[model samples]
Target: MISFHNEGGIMYRFIFLLFLSFQTNAADFVHPYPSFSEGEKLYTFPDFLNAHYYISYDSENKSASIKAEISFKTEEEGYPLFDLKENPTRVELDGKEIETPLVDSPKKETKFRVMNQLTSIGVHTLRVEVPLKFLLRYTDKGVDSAFWLADLDDRSFLENYIPSSFENDSVEMIFDVSFKISADQQIFANGEIERTGDRDFRITFPKEYTSSSVYYHTTPLGSFNERRFEIKSKVSGKVIPVIVYSKTISNFNSYEESIRQTMDELEADYGPYLHSSFIVYDADLSRWGLGGMEYCGATVTNLWAVQHELFHSFFGRGVMAANGNSGWIDEALASWRDGGYFSNQNMRERRALVLDFPYVKKTNRLAYSYGKNFISFLDGNTKMPIEMKLFMKSLYQKKSWTPITTEDLIVELDLFSGNSYQQLFDEYVYGNKSTLDASELWIEPNSSEHSIHRKISGEDLYKIL
Candidate 1:
């Protein structure tokens, strides 16, 4: 996390980074992503597309083989594009030589596979045409990628492709995945892995996954165990099971205690956590980034970034704001929760940030100013709590499980708070107003300076303002 302060004592900002680290042991796979089930069909969008993969690993040669199951919905018949790295040796499609197109200036691997002439639609099988070593090289970033073989030291298949879109109206598909690894190495995936042999395991997706990318990490650092939490929601009409992937097994540990507290607070405040599992990784800071990215039912976060990222389960992944502008709502709300709702420490740090950093001139006030101001306004306004609930509900009503824009949120705020958000926007967001008038609330100042500095408790601040 980075803190900025300004000499003018006008504005303060704390900019946080996505921390990365390497896992020391196998952590229980926690669903950092949102997931849901429709009828007997389970569905989630981890990224943008629906992907199913079968992977096998060979310990003797440090290699792996993969078969992908893919399905895309279109009004007309068309084939999906399979752009791959150049190292694959044997290429086949249902056991035949398929001509691969070579494009100039390939991003990673120079080759691409296109089934431009598919005779059928729905489910299609994509078998590897080349050797496993080539696919491994591509997934491992030429074997020199950072965090390669950090924990498991075994060969694995990882999907790195981005999905076309993340809308909620898309169709869902299931993944039937199986993997073979060395007897000594452990494997993890989206769902539970059922072992069939000493060297092979299979993972079945109980729901339709969203992302086109699948990730596999091979390390030798620590061990993992599976745990389940049943979440009964008052808002949604489902009992979601939350999976926890924790490196620590003991409940008395501080890490576990922190997680429990955070979970309790978040569940009490936000809606139920809608995932089968969540992963708590005891990883080194240099490997995976600071916080975890939300996957349908899985999230990857190091210990340091857990609380902040967990809060994101509600703000970022659950009620996703629109792209490019939603970063403010997602990040700032998470930061506020992590910092304990602008407690004394938070206020001190925020005051310092204003007095020490360059926040007044920042162009992206949506992220820095609007986020902080909304939090502060919520602290001050008596109607804020109910208004916030209504605001979130309005977002769901308007967007219907899709990402929404800031303008959408502003309208929702107007409806709930009975005040034009444009006025607040002009005063705080565009005009850069920080401190509210203490006189309006009948608060007496002990001393007057260029800026007012006082210790305000979270509860007192809420009541006073």
Candidate 2:
């Protein structure tokens, strides 16, 4: 569980880290992410939620609708905050109808739905209905639609179409997706799909899924062509299936070997791939090169960015970041892999990745460049025989599904390397307290990270999809 700490008007979620004489009990925590309740008032969320969404899409009219029934058990009197960017068609709390007033938070710069009435400490049920319009764009022969959400903004995860909770709570999300599409089509999701009826699917995700874990993309069969293949994981030798899809072009010939090599190396260095299968929506990513978004087991990527995005399946998507402040760890590791994982004896003169305020849910853009340099420094300079990479492999195996903080990473490093890395993190990663001579520092290029929002434009979305 998290307690709020207000300093200089910014509230921080203080996670109970294991530094004391006694270790914190395992069953007392939801998640370690710092998430603000975007309602009229701040509400403590101790409710574990499971949501089932019945979604129907009509591609001819470019419209859709979603009805979500969420069940939860509350420890105390609290508000069950769920976000649906589109004003919900209807909202029900415990089978009683409630007003769907849109709460606008200029501080968070988003609008979402929240329960106005607080519930008594017990199990509760909530229902939300939302309409999705104009989300489909027709191709010449087929149509293209994606429930695409990168961790781009405060309100951009699974909450866009279906009713979704915050990052701090892992929920089981079930999607009953039905289509009124005329063209023959198939749904691409990170979840396992079972065909229930004609043009209907029951997509069920793992019980331990958070907000940013699911990947859902839909298009006409010929609008995008796919090549399905299998690869043996390095650690477990588990035959993992991979599907690469593109806009009616067979451009995955050269990428097959790269994908195999990358997956093998990743599993060898880290552990088994957590995602049951991998799906790559290789949209060419040409409008801007070296940019893709990482989902749980799937990615939307190109040749140049394939390795970096796939590396995320282990670190970013697997060993998850609990909050935006902790978001630098994966980007740094992925970028370090991208930039050849160069270990440097000398530390670099770089800015901090964790900022001072309003950064609880925002990934620092400099995480790509400066963050990688710091990781390289850690990899090179360790008191123990093993470097930071080995520590990460162990961390991945231990904390695959658990969301963690930057402080947690530092503490783990301290324990693994048997040397204190806190001051280094304080001086370099969290605060710019170290002043070094420019000539003595290692200099890496100010390279952009692999994110579509930072690398591409609004016009590039359609092209990338």
Candidate 3:
């Protein structure tokens, strides 16, 4: 996996692009500075990233021919570092072709590096043709394709199919996508979509999205008997459109009913639903034991994990984990809700969530297990009844679309609870320094056999940011 290495003692003004344009010259999403050495500055990420993908999918051939025009800028000279698991058919730096040999061992991570004199201190563009991969597959009736990503999909995300950056930086992405399938396969995405042709779509995803935020899927007819309906959002008065699909119509009905109740319950708890619409890929997930993965407002889920996955739209995908260490916050929060918010359990296991590196893509596994009880314990320790729930709602309102850290959660909790829980985390969550070990840290391995259509996007797609 190609990731950044941050060195301490770096004091630099990184003009990060927020929801505003680069012309604003604003510094909204600044990279944290423990401090940077003169030598270490070269390894830091770019100031901004805007990627435009032109994709043409051929269903018969089961292939996707893709080209990405990635535009970015930097204040200082640095190398072009992009995490793409698939090798590019061709690479270009400012319209000039460059060789991207396999930088790592074939057994290791797939990586590409841009080497040219032009990679110095200004706006630059990398136009590359990404290689074809499993962006599509044949289901029994038709096909299923998705650019799905999750919290544990370490170093693999938007870059899994196209060229993209890390999750910390909310990159602006545009997709000019088209499909040449049996006229039956349909595209499902969470972005603003404009149909330009019979199967061509121009998708404009939110600029607030990071590497893991996009959820795009293409499923064929007969593979799923889909039912589209509407449900009113409690938080927002908008009548939210919902699409639920499954192999059978009975499953669709059951899922729709469950989704309605679940959405109402979650909205009653959290402030509101965060996405434009909600989509469910209700399937038998007995094969994938990990249950479900949540996208922004969508999920490929079984019936059991409906509430748990949807809760993520308000927390995990909504508030967003700034780094791997903070990733536990949502999982624990969701699992705590799953366990009925019981605040009386004894958290027997002690684990370490504080890792050496902040940007590790994998979260601590205990987040789904012991971490659940820990959050409940925190809630119990709070001053009011279900104070944690109220704090989470406030957090969802404030930090929605923002990336945050474990320390941020601590500070927020301290302010809301009027008590410091740092010592609680230091002892139970962080564990003893003498016995601290990162054995629990791991990435959720990608499984092709079964998945919650993990929260799986498009196009003014030709325009550059």
Candidate 4:
């Protein structure tokens, strides 16, 4: 939907140069721009084909040794750039060591560009040795931080500490992680974990075709309870490994059953579950305001909120949006799946909330509420229930790991509903024009039975709404 054609202006000419620099042959390159204010700065994205990360952690010193090898193909005539927070100790291009690691500092960016040496346009591999310092913060059980390693009567990590490339599309990234800790420590990764020695361990994840990020948790031995189970896919007859990590072992079986049921319902509504495994971490977040967040195939939340985060596997992380503005595409679908809106009246309230704040750029209340309401209108009023299912499955299959824009979603909606979503989108979504006519939007009130099919408690539902 984004065009970088020749235009007679300095801005257009600069953009054209950036387009040339961001070329990729892996797939048709779709630039995800025209986002919020920060959108204009993101002129390029990595067409990441494959990557391998070797991480070594020293719990005693809180330092890390990270070595990464990334293979990608781009049609850009100039050097490829990467966003790395820490400076690498060594850099290599296509198995040859460059005399100096070319680091270009553009104005007003937290990221430094890794200059590439591409003599010709083809597949090339870049290797770098990244030194991580104090990336781990020690905290107590009450603290709810993304990446924390703590010794609160026990030493453990909250995972999500691994430094990741910014906004890269999903690809087959092989990870080989090694951790050195106390003799009685255990490492929990999002990948298949294996114990190689007394104080050494390795976790290798399968190629994630539906996720753009990878993460893991490391803890002292026996610090947390672990339960391993499996869920059967009726569509593929494949059984997937499921792991639960909780501070206590109480009611783990019930949690597993709930997770299984949620997966079953989602797989039935959508297609088969995309990942080979799923993990739930019932983390103690008594202090942090936020309760839950979703990772690639793993989640950090309480036992009761497992379904909400699991649904994210199909929406948030499974099918990525282009930017924060398009984040509603995932958040709204996930909220609807969680029964955030149950009736046409509730949909009206959601629309009113969006109309109240028409120009908020970042993902906030408007994104979730309006998103759920819009989908509810389509499914309940327009009565495209069957097409809705097909559209979701097809969209998921096509844009599994790639980021899609609002325009991209409108195209899909138009194809499914056989109607234009421009007016609705402009009013409620992209443009925030606030000129949508609700009387013309609704077709009929949904049946009471269909309208009140909420699963969560009224109290929790109200909180989300």
Candidate 5:
């Protein structure tokens, strides 16, 4: 993992490129990403249209109550399965109370309960009320945890923390989410906010969203200093609100320019920014571990990490990979774009550094690096004259706010570049039987050239020109 370094009280972001010469065996490492088997049949399910969410929490407490109204259309006279992480206290369909039926002897991979309800072949509405409470725990240093907090300063990660529909599937959802907190506390969400009452704050996502991408955060009113501004796109003249909140007032202004540049460049490269507002939460340096994480229209990170996560608003969370199988696609594309490695030399250098990393089921950092190398090769190498912008723009236009698979992306690649990537996946991405030196991805140094190439181990060489 990359560590945050502070020199002379100034934050310096460093990306670790080299692996240890003597490291633990791969089998000993704890894999971060989970692989689900077919036995876990109760995964994300149910296709819904719109939802109205009302969440109320107290900053001094660890529990919150949520009430949701969901609307869906059934294809036939069959029950639709709803996957919920939390248990529902009450369920009503079409203004009538209904029993919450549970599937018996569900698949072994099912982590949460699945509800199957019979319905007619027409539009139906359901109201669900679920009460959620997270165990409050402190870190090793005795400070409050960011994931679940109720103290002097507070923030709740409501994406998975709150009760919602399936997370992976792509469904058109219009959200009307409101929050009720202390009157003195300030809240920020994905949409426009209105002060409903002295202690109630409501945020409505009027536009259609690809998934249940609703996210909001709250802190004490005066806990942090904030800077609010707006930027208009030259391509579409669409304006977006940008806000940066931080504990210290030193570097929040610098992020405005960085955000504007990133937004403008991405809009020109991909399409438009889909969300209404952008928020950057500069948590304390002690919360560095929580930083660099992305939400729908908000992120919690330092200035440099802002651009990478913001770009995810276009790629990773923006395009919405169908499942964990294709999650690397967006991360790889984001890293490649952030690295600005658009030339053969840049691709070669990146490939040399990341060739040994595992491309399949690797930790997020290594997976991201390996992905960066793979997309860099496809986008920058002269052997494949694929225009990165055109390919991405086409993908964005077609799969915006939708879930996609690796096979689906490969088909698009063949259509655009007239080349098949099945072999590429078999060798690197999906297969792990061969090392970098034995694979065809390595660019061997020329013997006639006077360049110095350092050999790491066996046939592995780090080419230098």
Candidate 6:
């Protein structure tokens, strides 16, 4: 009897262990930073807070140097990573020469090694000094702006400035940046101004936040009227104050309603608005093709691209993508959401933009097509509601920490749909079969083309004809 009781106790313990393992696996979301092995933890800031900046530009050499200092409180020792302009001639951290890895081409990143030995568990300082003269690559078209110190290049604009890492505790960060730029140009950055003097401006983040960028132009531009709104978080009851800056006063009115409506819809869909404040600044008309770039809470966009950038707050800024593969996930989701809104409003022209994925894929053939088509398929596939939740959970748990692939989606579909994704892939992606019978799926009897109807709610309608 004693032996039997002991065996029963052992069985109970084994079952408990299995239950714990499942819970741990389910809870895993967002990849831990690479430094986890180095005894570091990771945390993300809210989407609406903008990092403060202070910059002073030098006009003589047409080159700029910067000194950035950010303060954050933490329980465990952590490090900072700064994406530097490729032309950096010299970089000094805490007055010491530190080795920086050549992580990618045309974009250079340097990691500052915080002294964990002497540093205690509390507040820390990260000081970075950069010399930008080395970045100029002169071509026949004069100084190529491609090498400009602040250009985001291929990565998301936020990653360009902040060091993404693992952290043990939450902390507020304040960034004080000083830059030297051409005297003829005007400079702008994130947040409400504390002061502006001596060809330099100082900005402040009202809450805990991560990165900042400087915008400069040679020609002086007149300021437009600003529009403000207060967006409240449904979950936290926190409110995010917003401001929109434009070149012409009239342009502010054009984008105000769209921005407000987008924010309303986003907060309704996503968990909440994460930042204490947000800003949208006007960019040069000539550089409008670049669309908008996301920083912490602040985004710089052209007049026409304001709506698309606003949606970034939910996907791009809120749910961070670790690598290139998952990069398109947020972008495609945002495009669908923003574009779907127009379609629902009976604006067929605006809705047509969402259907033009084929043309976009053709234009950028090398880019990942899975994100675009996966979203479309999700709309058509009934199991997607459950699958997306499982997929996102898996994505967060797998901690792939980089971009995801089409195979990842297939695995997810298999899990949620309880059917092999091979059939779906062959029918939709590989063109081996058709999604629906063309003759039966037409919206209008006279229309020749077939329209495949999506099974998901909140998806745009389709009529191939």
Which candidate number has the best TM-score? 2
Task: Kindly report which residue stretches of model 1 are placed more than 4 angstroms away from their true locations once superposed.
Answer: 1-50, 76-184, 196-198, 206-208, 212-252, 286-298, 320-328, 342-386, 393-465
Give per-model TM-scores. Answer: 0.52, 0.84, 0.81, 0.69, 0.67, 0.51
Error of 5 at 177 (Å): 6.4
**Best candidate, lDDT-wise?**
2
Error of 2 at 17 (Å): 20
In model 1, state the lDDT of residue 56: 51
lDDT of 2: 0.71
Put down candidate 3 lDDT per residue, 3-37, tens digits, no spaces.
12233233312322222344333322534312112
Per-residue error for 128 in candidate 4, Å, reads 2.4
TM-score of 5: 0.67
Candidate 5 residue-wise lDDT, 368-454, digit = tens: 556667777777667667877789988887766665667678888888889887776665565543343423233333443211111
Ranking by lDDT: 2, 3, 4, 5, 6, 1
* Candidate 6 weakest ten by summed lDDT: 456-465
* Tens digits of per-residue lDDT for model 2, 1-465: 232223423223122233111222231133532335644555445444578989887767766788889886554455545577777878888889987566654344355565777776556788888886424565544456677666645566777667777665678889998888766767899999999987888999977677778888777776667789999776787889999888746857778888999998888888889989988888777555536888889888777778888898899889887766687789888888888879887775857777553324546666777788888888877443447778988899788877788878977887787788777788787675244222212233344444532543335665555
User: What does the lDDT read for residue 146 in candidate 2?
Assistant: 70
Clashing pairs in 5: 40-109
Give stretches of model 6 more than 4 Å off: 1-54, 58-63, 69-83, 87-95, 98-127, 132-152, 155-173, 177-193, 196-225, 229-239, 249-251, 284-290, 339-370, 383-465
- Please give the lDDT score at residue 84 for candidate 4: 51
Residue 417 alpha-carbon offset, candidate 1, angstroms:
5.0
Worst 10 residues of 2 by lDDT: 19-28
lDDT of 6: 0.39
Candidate 4 residues 1-465, lDDT tens each? Answer: 124233449887687566555543222234422111232232233455676777676656656677878776544444555555455677787788753332423322123344444434446677878775433432221111123221110102211223233332445555555555544555655666777765555666555432234555555556677789999897778898998887755568788889989888888877778776898877643223334656667876676567877887887667765443465677677766667535442234324322222111223334344567777766665433434556788888777766666778888888766788777666446443355332222222233322211222223312321
